[model samples]
Target chain A: MHSESSPLGEFDLIQRFFKAGADAMRSNDQKMIALGIGDDCALLKPAAGEEIAITSDMLVAGRHFFMNANPELLGRKALAVNLSDLAAMGAKPIGFTLSIALPKVDAAWLEAFSKGLFAIANQYSCPLIGGDTTAGPLTISITAFGSIPSGKAIRRSGAKVGDDIWASGIVGDARLALAALRHEMNLPESDLKQIEHRMHNPTPRVELGMKIREVASAALDISDGLLGDLQHILNQSQVSAEVFLDRLPKSETLQKQSEDIQNQFAASGGDDYEICFTAPIDKRDAIDQISTALNLPLTRIGSVTKTAGVLEKLSLLNKNGVLLDETKSAALLKSFDHFVK
Target chain B: MHSESSPLGEFDLIQRFFKAGADAMRSNDQKMIALGIGDDCALLKPAAGEEIAITSDMLVAGRHFFMNANPELLGRKALAVNLSDLAAMGAKPIGFTLSIALPKVDAAWLEAFSKGLFAIANQYSCPLIGGDTTAGPLTISITAFGSIPSGKAIRRSGAKVGDDIWASGIVGDARLALAALRHEMNLPESDLKQIEHRMHNPTPRVELGMKIREVASAALDISDGLLGDLQHILNQSQVSAEVFLDRLPKSETLQKQSEDIQNQFAASGGDDYEICFTAPIDKRDAIDQISTALNLPLTRIGSVTKTAGVLEKLSLLNKNGVLLDETKSAALLKSFDHFVK
Candidate 1:
């Protein structure tokens, strides 16, 4: 299928590199895949009494990552971000498809990219089922599919007025990493190294999400920022919330920043692939126990209110438990909209 | 959700236009979609005893289409191409997710694009389940999911020796249309107008594909011309085939071209979203009847043979049923690979 006019056909290229990933997954005892690549469509049989959960995320060269970003880490992050979405839904790992546009056929870049992709895929038992590759501006779009019990899938619209808002793991480290990368903040070399992996290779809270499904009323993964993403839960649940600034968890490295820097970046910064959720006050003990069992931090930063609209009137409180000043509150309200750049 | 700095947030943008389309699909009494957008992941429940068939395709500007292509037609083509893959596998349309990277948020372009996208989605009963939209070079990647009876999907690896090869609808018209657009050859304005739709807005042969499932031993969609795509089936089935070039169906406009032009374009040109399949010789009468019932042009273009290891030795015959000359056959083997340019 290779020719001078056509260097390498799409199918041939895929077969040469990506097919091994699909084959590796098939070689495992995965019963869901009836067919993999090398076909018009890959056939998947969902587990009995399960509902498939689907999520897609796109990463562009200049927008999502640097043009010279490591292909290996980029590939891992591309699939990891989508996996984070599935984690927010408490869905078990199933399968995924990748649609990538490359500027050129760099065999070395592709080799490293697929290696990182399949590494994370096999780690989570989510196989690469199918994908399409083309020539264009470098962009990676990954769609991950998972499954949950038929009637037990977690949703964003199930929050109650009295539910306590919680977040999995530390937040703002990825944002801090970005700040160091952009030269917006002068961080020590050791601090930058500490959060670099948090920015490039996020750990999807799949296990924590699945453990909290029994208690959490509403859930979603934080990508844009904690404040902005929490607004989504508030909007979908038709309620308001009060987030305590001092209660927001941060890493030791992030804590080294000034008070104002810590507050703004932790509250409004982007790329925090952690789970933000809400659960009834009565289930707090259970959530805490699960968090301890999983060895991950699940901090309660706020509580849902009976307000009837979205997060329009959501309040941000100071360490003294008083509402923040109007100017600071307004800053927190202005989210990092990706299109706003 | 709307601000001066951000005209429309991603969530708000989706709610404004795309949500209505999702709501329309939900209002149709279809129970497959448990949840649509506005969540971390959309939940889908396939029909009982069905296997979900998944396929993804990416359309890039300047490569797959002209940069100034009509937004509406581009939207339709993006989804239709993926639907064509499901058709090749005899899968019933179910749902799709779109991951679009736009250079900017032009409301009018988005409106027209969504209108065209929903038009075909509704017509085929395939709802828009979920997707991700970001800022980048204009690129549309769609992952379509369909369902077929468990264990009944027509695969490309199923063809046996002595099977009759068939194709639904005319081939090479899309190629002819592309050639005209590229100005490689001269054509009448009427001829250009006649085949332009075939090139831009292709009709996936879903009904014909479903009907032929019982008869087709192997099947695939002709996206990269007849000879090249047929080679996919051959490679997968580990068999060879003899394609009668003269028997390849062509539109009236295409038939007016020279023999060399007709043969080359019909055999190797890409973008024909027609179904090319194979069935046992004994099923000819039944296939013919099914073709008549569906009112699709089902042409018998070749037959399968016992040859192992891909389509390396596949033969192409001329009008008089003789193998094509070496030069012509070599030309027919060169496909439209995007990397070549």
Candidate 2:
């Protein structure tokens, strides 16, 4: 896939691929991006009484995806995952910076990659601003910027005791796709087609996140799996959680799996890019209306509680109110840690 | 260098190295960073009438540095290069995000790396507000944020004809150090010691950039050689330049090199985090005062000109006012493009 032409200088490559992508996808974020690519630094001018929300994420070849993964989907997923972080905080998409290390320049690959990147960027009104390009093993690092009204960002530390834990959309399909890809499981053609997009093009819940700011006391995107990601809110807010294991939201395709597989995958499916949030019990009706309005499932799966114990920041319980044993719970899910297996 | 106690998960690794670095180096940028680590997104709150400047740069192992390079200095240079981008825009550093991928967790290496990162971060009051850590071949990506008063940033497109071009500090020591390291040439131990630090630890002229904003019509930091980087200003401002090769700044150590070597390195040395700027001839005295107040050498090296031709963006001449032959000028420098040698 390497190009046969003369080596592309960094500037020419950037202008040919990324700059063209950004220019085609130029959004209404002019107030946020005062100056873009072509300068030493991009200028971000926020409106009065607003603050910028920033997050960074990195994806490495072979680790995050197969070395042969589609460049278009890879580029789309790279930016989508970062945007989901902003969605978790109820922030409006503003702009992003990309720093990529490539094995070599490939013209066709870059063309498809830029197409995917700009398609999603334009959809979310998030513009590309500034970045660095270098030569190395393949890696893509994106730092996404979003804006929120002053003092209005929903934070992971805001969950309180007695809050209801809610999750947006389905969670397990992406994990299932991974299993199939790894050859640990086999899926019928129809099933793979039904669910593979969850592993490829995740839909960042930007509008839902912005709309839920008043409802969710605390929130985070479930990129690392539901139970593990929810632990972040519990640990940050200094609260404990009791989750009803059977209540996890799952797609129709995921429901066709065995009971054990469904529960485990639904609980710990990394790359779901769904929102796991906590809110006061009083906001249940409002949340339901929001879910309906957005045509997305907002499932109530658990509740915040006083400390269960120091070793246990969160707990999984059967619908019968019996706590799952440590062995079963441990086997079911833990957040996906990049450094760990 | 691997740690045996346990595998450091993403969050733990981040908390152990980067968060600790940031906490120790916490600066008064609390006004800019409203929220820091342990959140879905870090919040940046720019004060009244101020805008944010953002830039990202990535450094990869084996490509940007040796596999066995000093961890501490590597960490320092990574952030230094990015902060220099802000300095080019005449912005005050506020905060930054780091996304790192490592082959394995080395506790000692990370400790030293974090120490070096925080040492300079604290010096500049540029706190680390957020970051992501993962496992892969070593790569470090940083997106730094700075604050500039609205409409006050020095941009690359602002250079005017007859504008005097200036460069901050000496330029070729880092390149000389690189040559020594590569064994392309040899230096005495004392000379090597004097020049090596220029490569290991570049000082981003932050305060000088802020001070020169009013005087410099256009500005950029010299990370990628002076002549090549200046081409960016000329390209943006639709101007050309005539540089006096003998007037290019060099240290006493660099002056010991052959005249041809000195001229080549000074004109096109990469990784020198000095600022190159342009201002109307009338502002020379003001720029001189800024240089004196900062106790940094500000050298007048060239002047902006109308385009000589489409292909020739900049021309270099000797003291006799004769333009250097195309072969010599071509031999001297082209911006160091990462994709090329």
lDDT of 2 at A13: 92
Best by lDDT: 2
The alpha-carbon RMSD over the true interface for every model, in angstroms, is 1.5, 4.2
Q: In terms of TM-score, how similar is model 2 to the real structure?
A: 0.97
lDDT of each: 0.87, 0.88
lDDT of 2 at A217: 95
Instruction: Tell the DockQ for candidate 1.
Output: 0.77
DockQ of each: 0.77, 0.63
> Residue B183 of model 2: what lDDT?
94
In candidate 2, what are the lDDT values of residues B1-341, reduced to their tens digit? 01222466666778888887777765464677889877989999889999899999999998888899899998888889889999999999998998999998788999888888887888889989997888999999999999999999999999999999999999989999999999999889899998899999999889988998888999999988998888888878988889999998899999999998899899988889999999999998888889888999999999988865553378899988899998788766577878875
Q: Which portion of correct inter-chain contacts appears in model 1?
A: 0.85
